[model samples]
Target chain A: MTNQSSWFETAVADLVDPQDQRVWSIIVSLFGDMAQEPGAQISGGALTQIIEPMGIKPEAIRVALHRLRKDGWIESDRIGRVSRHVLSEFGRTQSAAVTPRIYARDSAPVEHWHLLIAEDGTGTQVLEDVMLSDDYIPIGRNIAMRAGAAPLQAEGLLALDISPQTAPKWIQDRLCPPELRASCRALLTAVQNAAKTHPEEWTPTPLQSATLRTLLVHRWRRVVLRQPDLPAAFYPPDWVGPACRNSIIRMLDLLPRPSAAILSGSG
Target chain B: MTNQSSWFETAVADLVDPQDQRVWSIIVSLFGDMAQEPGAQISGGALTQIIEPMGIKPEAIRVALHRLRKDGWIESDRIGRVSRHVLSEFGRTQSAAVTPRIYARDSAPVEHWHLLIAEDGTGTQVLEDVMLSDDYIPIGRNIAMRAGAAPLQAEGLLALDISPQTAPKWIQDRLCPPELRASCRALLTAVQNAAKTHPEEWTPTPLQSATLRTLLVHRWRRVVLRQPDLPAAFYPPDWVGPACRNSIIRMLDLLPRPSAAILSGSG
Candidate 1:
């Protein structure tokens, strides 16, 4: 392999998450990033070409596809001898739900925030229901917060629309845990380093671009989706969420989104 | 008794709190209302003359005075044949703390209010401490609210400075229970009825004026002090707090505070 090709391989190794390698999740990220638009489809060969170089075997990709099909997240079709996959209606809805937050360059710093507090023990289930269905972040056993001016319809809970003043250590820790902070910091560092070493004059071929984009979107999806979208006050003192987000956006901008034609090798 | 004297007697009976006639607490209310100034004293005979018409025997008055002395609330002085009682410094301090709220002609609406929520179960103790020391009204097991913009220095508790938008039934009931509302409504009705029948031209003797003042203060104190001082939203829909306060103030205005010299029989 040429030096440039070796650098590309090393970059992929550095970018992919070491802790989570669920192939099904990786394929979901792939579809969410590239083929989320209606009628967008990826040929079977193109899917292998994009994901296999991340050290996943073709059989692993097939198994992940089988699982995705079984879960009703993707539908498969055959034209002549080539099989292609498209996001199912369920998959499209799920992807659309988070697409704005994941792809937003700058989220409109959640203007209005409210809190919901349950009674100590018996109200635990009520607060849990609000947290799960209403996008509330639980700050304590009986306390949860969400971004909105409108009060939640929690019957036994006290709701307060608040402008957050000071977030202490425990609240910061609860909202952004140590592990999440570390993951964000790790991603920021990797993306920054990759950007630094990337050659300025080089133009990647379609296959090369596909490989890089897959790795970038896969890692970013893990970090971005895991983060609680909140105002700056909610993050820990040393959280690198903003830096990681900026770095992820800058890196994705560098690797322009390849058209399905280019990714399918028909350009 | 003449017609006017009979009217005075009936008015005194109507004004005294039917539920609570604790003589010691009545004396506290008298001192807090008419003699809160430092060096203020009430002659023992005058104290009896004022409270005796509330149907409490002089021996009961002596027993209540004994209890008050034992509780560090009052001190006694004797010079030859006359005895006098004065609120102890501790008693004065305790009485002064709630006097303004109890006697104010109009309570300035609580503009800023805040809620503090502790973690369920384990955090009950923290919230309890805040409620005991601060002016927090406990609305739920883990939730308490207080008036002010100042954030409480309660660690591990989620504090939100909220301008109440809406308060539901449970919170309203928690802050102003049925018993409190009934007490307020009863006081309002009694004071309104007394105000209607009071003879404007009748000039009361100093002792009669003292008796009227003591009865009004005693009943009003029971209602006012029992209330959790919170914003209007916290009260029940049928709450008569404002009406009771208005009636009490009007009644108290009619029964002007007698001079200490009159109360001491030395005017």
Candidate 2:
């Protein structure tokens, strides 16, 4: 049963070794006094109450119980609807010498990379969108070129929405900096600023820039990947040949921009 | 071999399953192709070359190769320095459709978190030290009256760095909120602002505001947790008591400023 789950969920399973160890430490620290009772069904609520002394994630107790059960060290059974978990003999043996150290995922904290948990508890943030900047463009183009695909084909591969025909004009005019005309990337700024104000509506502003088209094209990729493809009507009217958009994407990927830094503009 | 490597490295192993199916897609697709050529030695350069065509991590390639080997779908022989990984008949028979899809972890692009990675990738960010606010006295005094910790023990816990003999004045002056006293948390602002500017030299600018010591004594619980012992000098000269300080920390957590807005601040 465990192997099957591990096969499907390799990550959580893999973490069973380390994350499990930490989970066990917390569990044992709470129940050390109750160590002799083999089959005692400790209420999950009681587990949270135990950790009330420490300030951390509210759901960490539930997660600890779940991981414990997965590792065969604990067995949880429900009485009425209240879930109760108990340590197995193996768990008792394992928890003998653990010093209950806090296992935050940071090996060491660095100045540039902060591990932030939202104080608002909504853990949502902006790292969600895959950027379409000068830096990312060259990478998109080159990967496609290496895959023996032209610019448009590359865009499809990179999951960018832009077509090959219009891709070059977009890249040349906006994406690759130093060569970019300030007016070309104006649409991107407009889109980003607009996103801040209206969190839901995705349509571009009246500028009708490549960034807007790029988002639409990406949306189509999602549509294609999730819901099967639409018939050829998905193709544009008088669609030109050889994926013209790809050439532009290829040129963009050919750039040497560092992946992390933005090409221009401040937050 | 792949499983062994994965057991050691979570990021590499994570490239396998639901971390984002796109990662798995890349892994399986590239491995499937490479597995066909059993005699070819898969070098890091070759793997790098292949992934360059796709724009993913080298670790991802190693992980996929390991997974294939672990599942007995592939057999690998290491001769001198090169690893020759060959797919078994079962691998050929599995009719898996390898499409490009993002995995759970990689599903989100990582541009948003205000993570402070070292600029030179060396100096790490460690919290110099953490202490509760200046208003330790009044807060503890209030808790003292309520059904809180024992008066003696509570007093000790709140003492933090302050002495028991001088606790009351600190709490009354520095620790309590405006409704409790005449002042809001202005002293907190000054101390915190200084810490933010130079964490190494974190000293409260207003060290001698007559009531501050009383505030410190009262809020001792903020500086310390419940097990309170210490015969006296556990606190430094600037050591605010536990109760008031911990409360101040709690208050600070409430100010949820979103990481300087999604740092395209690479201007």
Candidate 3:
């Protein structure tokens, strides 16, 4: 909260790249919480409730879960209609080891992101950002805000930082092992790049490259104009040209500044 | 474009406050090149081409516009089947004036906000916040890169800046007067706050002083959570609580960062 602008900057940075690391983050968070509550099967509403604050749509969650299952990292161990993540033995070992790709912690997973979907109880799909960051803080707190989770949910982002609210049970029991954070970071960044290059496209195993990021940036520029805050001139060099500049600038001058926050984990 | 988090924050803000002003920001941007076209009238695909990037759910836009027309500020001057802004005496006054609310544009206007009805577009619907920062940068450019009226489009935001791009006559022509800017700031803030407090229940004139800002923040909080970089715990004090903290925080922690920048805008 204190270092908001910088925090905001990084949070936004994750968005500029392509990939779907954030979706994994949501999945990890889901499993983590599920692991903690004994006899507690994470219900449909519970998942929906948690994601409400985050911009992530419900549809995205289902897709991510399916993708995770396909990747062999997670499986469904269902008791009736309720769902529980069944991490494969390999998944468990990796959760402890921290693969250089997506970090898989069974507890205290981040679900700070949420999006509104026009789907069923599972919720509609949200943006699936699968990029990884080189740092855990970036992976944890920054992107969490983008999902709309409250500030409290994002505190876990800093490994060595003191959490005013997180309890001993959650932290001590759920830590993903700091060593594996690096691999997760790399994985996050890679997936992020891939998603950007293909906005309408989806791929669980993305290359996560710079080429993808440029395309994402281009996409964002388009977003600004459609938003109509300014004219073509205000838009980044990539999105506009002279003939139209005449009418666009008038709109840019009209918008006001914006503020946002994200909360996760049962809120 | 470089500041995606900020841009998204703005979008989140608008979504949260889907009142006339914020909603108009969403819609006018949807108007796309048409809104920026000075005298041009907008139609179907053109609207979609411009709007999809802004992420304005077409449904939301319809709801808001329907409500705006019911209120008053907007009425249509029918050239044919599709109506154009009669550009009311109020419309012309608003559109031509340095600032739109040249008269008593305050609580009274807000009270009458709902008066702007959807009746055949016969009257000028006071466009609260039509046009976005991004609207004119590209389409009207005839697809030109450097030569389109990019400068015109970027106006106050770009043209008047220290390093002005090549000036666009149109951009310069549309510059909002200084006084109007101040009024806009205040009006926008008031409208923004009201929209936040009132979400789906929004109207041009919300009787509840509880203000729409409250719900707007909550709804937007939903979107904020989607980012992977942000942790679930990283939310503002207003949103954190027994409600969303845990799930959001845990989820964010599990996600990856530097995901894809799926959408963006001047906001």
Candidate 4:
């Protein structure tokens, strides 16, 4: 048990974001990963047990919860002497929107792609409006592309059905910038190290499982959601996106999600 | 014979360029249409006979010949006290390059087209360089397209093999601007009028055939060469490009090319 505890500490340390760690954002990630269902709620004690061990203070978690409640991302209720929190309706909608991308294991390469080109000065606003959807990626200031045929509402732009033939270094670099590549590589290494350093015959308690799942999903969400699912040709030579995705999926499968009842009870 | 002469005079007046009449450009058209072969020459008398009837003075023809000779478009030789002019080597090469486009009766619509997109700021120069070729049409400052698969030397741009599915009004307008559409319509009307006004039993002399052929080819060249052979969808609604091409072809068939020997001898 002591060995397993030590491994769990090490894994928590490995997954905590080294950059700016806003407690509210972390709480959002936690709720999005664990309690995203309509009525699913996490007790205040279970949230602390899952988050406080990541070097975050209990007071910081309380403040983040207050902020989330005020912003309508979370709702809190008191059951006698204990408190429980659940995602608000708006929050659940937002979480459900990106859940597919976060949990996608393997996406087939998109074959049919189209380009939307706007006129230089006046048509930029139309392209910008279209690019607000996640389906499109901006190729240039006036050009946006998507992995489908042209839409029927393409009134003010020139839309063409395109098959990508050759992607140059500039575009590859633009799509998968160096920082994204580095983030993917770092997450890949972190997950691999976490997997490798596990103690033999180790089993995590319900709280420990919830903690690891939240951390892994949080860090992986930050990486996966930052990039669109471009074809392999658009990725730079050193981009490890696919490998990182595989490692993340492997790690998530290893740490199956714990029920909210078990997590709150253990705490 | 007098009636034929009056008809010929009226035809010449109708065919004269309402815009600038640079005699050098007209001569280029004449040589390109009638005497493009190596060692084929037009005697100075024949040139005068073809050009002087268009209200241009003999001295203006002399000055234009001097300019053509200085610009390396025509080389002159003294043949038994009569001057003869043939296309210079450089001029013949330049004229030969555009002959296929000018004389093409019908071009099979290009099915395969590709786009080359450049990075926003710095890659504009690369796209501009590629746009210097006649094969490409500029869609924007950073985008150029051609009617084929991606080339082997696509160094600095993103190349896409595109099947154009829709072209908006702006693109159609850009490809066939208002001025070009007006020119096409005007030439179509002119040719139809010329074809309508021909009297019965009109057999043009060799010199008259050369003159009428020169006028028709020259006028059509100005219109056809200004626009690339884009797909039919790219042309504006009122663009008469195909109809104008058919009229020009029909007129040329009616006025068969006269032999150089007969033309010069008639002069």
In order, how many clashes per candidate?
0, 74, 195, 0
Model 2 DockQ vs. reference: 0.00
Write out the backbone clash pairs for model 1: none
Chain B structural similarity (TM-score) per candidate: 0.94, 0.25, 0.25, 0.93
Q: What is the fnat value (0 to 1) for candidate 4?
A: 0.85
Provide the TM-score, chain A, model 2.
0.27
lDDT of 1 by residue, B1-267 (tens): 677898888888788888768889888988887778888889898898988988999999999999999999999988887888888999999999987888888875575888786766777898898788877887677778778874746677767788775666767776777888888888788878878887878778878887887887777777778755677666777988888888888776767678889776566
TM-score of structure candidate 3: 0.17
lDDT of 3 by residue, A83-202 (tens): 555556655555444321122111132333221111111111111122232121211111211223222322112111111212222122122223223323433443343223433322
Candidate 4 positional error at A46, Å = 0.5
Candidate 4 residue-wise lDDT, A1-267, digit = tens: 588899999998988877867889888888888888878888888889888889999999999999999999999988787788889999999899999998899965566778899999989998898788656889899998888788765867988887665589988888788888888888888888999998768888877888888888888888888867776667788988778888888888877677767644433
| Full ranking by lDDT | 4, 1, 2, 3
Model 2 docking grade: incorrect
Listed models, DockQ each: 0.47, 0.00, 0.01, 0.76
Error (Å) of candidate 1 at residue A149 is: 0.4
Q: What is candidate 3's lDDT per residue for B1-267, written digit by digit as tens?
A: 334334333533443434334555444322221232233333332333334434456666556555645665344444445434422244334344322121111211011000011111211121111123222221111110111122433211211111121222222222222333333343345334433443342222111111122223223232322221111222222322222323323322322221111111111
User: Interface RMSD values for the candidates, listed in order?
Assistant: 2.8, 31.3, 22.7, 1.3
Residue B127 local lDDT, model 3: 18
